[model samples]
Target: MKVKIYGEGAEAQELLDKVNNSLEDLGLSDFMEVEVTMDEELKNSLSISKTPALIIEEEAIDFRDTIFEGIVPSDEEVKSMFISIIGGGGESSGGCSSGSCGTCSTGCH
Candidate 1:
């Protein structure tokens, strides 16, 4: 699994630390690879409009999704998201299995 955190500045750093701690506490620090980026081009390519966005990329499949944006998510939320993604089963927040119901901003469909 590959995780990307996009942002620059103090708030971004804080979020990064929180995410890292959560990953460690969840015992995912060894299995997952993380990258913190401040590249404007990469952020624009991902259409990340807010700072401290968390993107998860699954290596077993051609799947990449943004699970968090803007506000920081709780440790449990982070763990749940990872579990769902890794397990390949979860209800979509957009009410569409494909995640393209026009309600989700991640553009997963």
Candidate 2:
């Protein structure tokens, strides 16, 4: 899977960090590639009218989807979105039985 984050400035960087953290927490950092692009032409091509848009692509299935337009999603939301896209069972196996462990809750698992 490929994840692309589009935006500029501090907000973009913060969102990028959140995405990275979430991916790492989910143990998917090694399996996925992430890219951040602020090219206006690229954004135009994607028809993204807002900054901080996240685009996910799965080459094997020729699937391309976009989310988080104009708003930064929470860490859990981002993780869940990716999990759903990859068709994972979405059950975290870490020590967060209540789904609220410190690491998991802070998106730093």
Candidate 3:
């Protein structure tokens, strides 16, 4: 999986940091490719009309899906989306492989 963050300035950097942290926390940092860009042409190609957009691409399936644009998503939401994209095959050996750990009042196993 490939993740792209498009924008400039501090907001974009913050988004990038959030994404990187999420990937690391989920144990997917090494499995994924991440990039940040302020290129107008690339943004146009993806129809990204807003800054701080997040695009996720799965090359195996020839898919490049946009997660959000012009807004920052919660870290948990980002992690949840990633888990869903990988079909819930997260590296976690616990029951939270279902990726509902965020909703668990007691936390993940």
Candidate 4:
């Protein structure tokens, strides 16, 4: 799948790096590609109107909300984020594969 992340600033690089690492760690690196776009007109066309806007496959997965607020997604959210960014092809293990949410309060907590 092809994913594009838009965010112009010092943190832009950092966020991209983290995202890439996450994908790689999950063994999805070989199937995905990430790009950092910095076209102002393109940004406007996407209705981003803000920095740190992400366009994943013609859809705006993330915009200013995450950028300005400095809110990182929960690990599960990040895993599910695969759908928005990538087109999706792998079969999930059903339960949380990351196990990063051992303290999650959804039900097991």
Winning model by TM-score: 3
Candidate 3, residue 106: lDDT: 29
Higher-scoring candidate on lDDT, 3 or 4: 3
Residue by residue across 5-76, what tens digits does model 4's lDDT show? Answer: 677576666657666877876778887778888877667666665555444453345332122223334444
1-109 per-residue lDDT for model 1 (tens digits): 8888887777677767777887787777898888888778767777888878887777688787666777666555555555555453354453323443343334432
**Judged by lDDT, which candidate is best?**
3
Q: After superposition, how far is residue 67 of candidate 1 from its true place, in Å?
A: 1.4
State, as a TM-score between 0 and 1, how close model 3 is to the true structure: 0.76
Candidate 2 vs candidate 4, lDDT winner: 2
Ranking by TM-score: 3, 2, 1, 4
Q: What is the lDDT for 12 in model 4?
A: 67
Error (Å) of candidate 2 at residue 52 is 1.0
TM-score, model 4 to reference: 0.55
Worst-scoring 10-residue span by lDDT in model 2: 100-109
Model 3 gets an lDDT of 0.74
Candidate order, lDDT descending: 3, 2, 1, 4
Worst 10 residues of 1 by lDDT: 100-109
For each candidate in the order shown, give its overall lDDT on alpha carbons: 0.67, 0.72, 0.74, 0.52
RMSD of each: 5.3, 6.8, 6.3, 7.4
TM-scores for all candidates: the values are 0.69, 0.75, 0.76, 0.55
